[model samples]
Target: MGKKSATVVLAHGAWADTSSWGKVVVLLQSDGINAVTFRLPLTSLADDVTALDKVLALVDGPVVLVGHAYAGAVIAATHSAKVRALVYIAGLAPDQGETVADVFNRYEHDEKAPKLAPGDDGLMWLAPEAFGIAFAQHASPEEQKALAAKQLPISPAAITVPVERPLWKDVPAWYLLAQHDHMIPEKTQRFMAERMNAHISAYPVDHLPSVTAPELVATVIVDAVRFVDG
Candidate 1:
């Protein structure tokens, strides 16, 4: 195999830590792709983007930034020239002047999806059952329990604030639409992908496919890396 010089930076979504990308990271490394997972503070869109920028600066080569669910907005909120391509896994993409809430709420939420509201801490959290019920229903009982235990809470500021001009407009983009995602409707994902002209790869997976269907997640990211490496 040819030497793969590009790096894949994985960003986890709301209510998740970097551990969510555990499976995908192992698979990318096995294929000789340098991969790293960036943890979002779930504070605000600006904070997450700033944190990602710091991680991008440390990498030595071009990058194929990959985001899952809500992290999709974090990955696109950067101005890093090193980021050559973007891969969105059941991600949310908002256009310029639009807020993440705008795009995420464009389509009606599934009845099974949880009603998210911030606790007294001013941070919104996902209920433990939501992991098994909607987030990653495909995941095993043990895995779902573990996923719920280490969850993070996202700030309303992160979703309510408007996104800047998206990097997908200029960078090559690949979208993995999760057909079974109850959180973000499949039709909503399609609308965003088509709006950005991203290459679409739909799969019968839930919102957290990076956790339940790592192979497919890795493949889409690898494809984006190859496109940039070429």
Candidate 2:
């Protein structure tokens, strides 16, 4: 298989939708790599994994699974055989018996990180004002506003649920660490990436590097595609 023959499935993190991967998808498509993104309901970890599994089933041949933020854990929980590689974009990779919250709270959060709280509906959202600075500081004012407007709230239960055997332990993996991320500390991202034995690509971007630095993000994903296809 070649890079163009492999499908790249992208999973967005919490407080984001498929649009989060818009730029990367465009780049991948332009390169003749089949790229697609799925919408995780942000309801629970299991549900998100199942949703990804469904997307995987729809894709033909080999796939490189790319995840961001919470979707990192969601992609790891998948047992799909079609997934040839796993790519983490400042994603959380929890080991078996560990919940996303466990890994998330392991490190001291950045002081500027937004204080997240679940509404009565049990969905957690980032503060609208914090979206620009904390999430995507590198993005333009118009892009930041669009991101805030289309943001999706994740359920609290999603973070608390323990993960199964992480796919990273079985499949080759790559991690793109956002150095300026306030939501998940850079130290934490390094820790998780090292534990997964992932190929690391560190950049001076914020949490939403897929939006802020899509070219860099696409380059990393394309590397993974080549690696897996070879």
Candidate 3:
């Protein structure tokens, strides 16, 4: 990809901040693809999308939005005309009238996956131990620890709210399926990808491929960028 190609804006999922995309950003930068990441307020879907819209407004050219986990829904809700393509990495793509919780709870839960509920704080928190187990089992123990420590609690309102017309319906999209993901089951990923008819790339990775397998994540995003900017 060229330096002036469609810039990639990586969006972090629930329980994560912008740092999750650091490694992927570095890899994309090495390829002369301008990749940037922004923080999503986990307060609510509207809040997160507004934050992403503000960031999208700052960029100067076409964009390929890459979202992981819950950010998938956040990215697809954008009204930005500059977004040409979308890349969903182990993401949750809830259709119009469907909430993130709808997609998440549609399939049977993996035994290792942590059961989630809003805590007394009114935000959903992933247990630190669950991070090493289901969130990123493929990641190194040290990496898992860091991920757990760096998470931002996602508000219950974020996932329970229904999304508007998803941009994926209008834009070309790509999906990276994490085959071994315990958090969001592989079947669900496949269902969402096929529903969107997105170009699919499957890997024997976990949910947090941006952290555990940055190279793989970056490759799929670069593919989207090439297609959109070609």
Candidate 4:
């Protein structure tokens, strides 16, 4: 593996903020990789992509853009030449003409998944009990509480927006499949990763592996950085 020199920009998914990548950031920096996390507003797809692009603009040299869940679509929307590679951590990767919702609803819904509902403001939020049962079953009681408290509501229109061109089509990509994910089915994840022809690392972790298994998440990201650096 090559030494760490590239910037690793992490994009968090829906119902999450930049703090979601906290542990992973620490690990990456400890390994001497320039790591930064982007905060998505969860308002609209275009808005999120613009936020990611701004972060990419400030980064120097080669970058390995990492996205978790919904942020996958955000990272894929970028056409930045500075981004040499892409990494998906149980992320959603939609193709041209297909909306994030289209790919998300492609498979049979998991029975254990949370019942999501939108508020009058057109924002969607997971049920309070969802944090422990569906979203992050492997997380501790305290960790789950923290996650629930910090949850960011997502706009319904964000998922409905279609992706024009996914950056994964041009950049080398890697995927870390969460086998125990309830938010996104494991089969759906595999299908998308295979379609993108991404180098995949399957793990027996839940949806929030970056929190429940930071070591594994950081390892996969570091490996992708090494590949890009080489």
lDDT by residue (tens digit), candidate 2, 37-148 = 8899989888898899999999989999999999999989888889989999999999999999999888999788988888887789877778887999888999888889
* Model 2, TM vs. native: 0.97
Error of 2 at 63 (Å): 0.5
Scored by CA lDDT, what does every candidate get? Answer: 0.93, 0.91, 0.92, 0.91
TM-score of each: 0.97, 0.97, 0.97, 0.97
- Looking at candidate 3, what is the lDDT of residue 106? 81
List the pairs of residues colliding in candidate 3: none
- Model 1, residue 9: displacement in angstroms? 0.4
RMSD of 4: 2.0
Q: By descending lDDT, how would the candidates be arranged?
A: 1, 3, 2, 4
Residue 15 in candidate 3, Cα distance off native in Å: 1.4
* Candidate 3 lDDT tens digits, 22-127: 9999999999899888888889999999999999999988999999999999999999999999999999999999999999988897899998988998889999
lDDT of 1 by residue, 37-144 (tens): 977998999999999999999998899999988998989999999999999999999999999999999999889989988899999989999999999899999989
For model 1 the TM-score comes to: 0.97
Q: Please state the error at residue 154 of candidate 3 in Å.
A: 0.5
Which pairs of residues collide in candidate 2? none
Worst 10 residues of 3 by lDDT: 1-10
Model 3, residue 21: distance off in Å is: 0.8
Candidate 3: residue 61 Cα off by (Å): 0.6
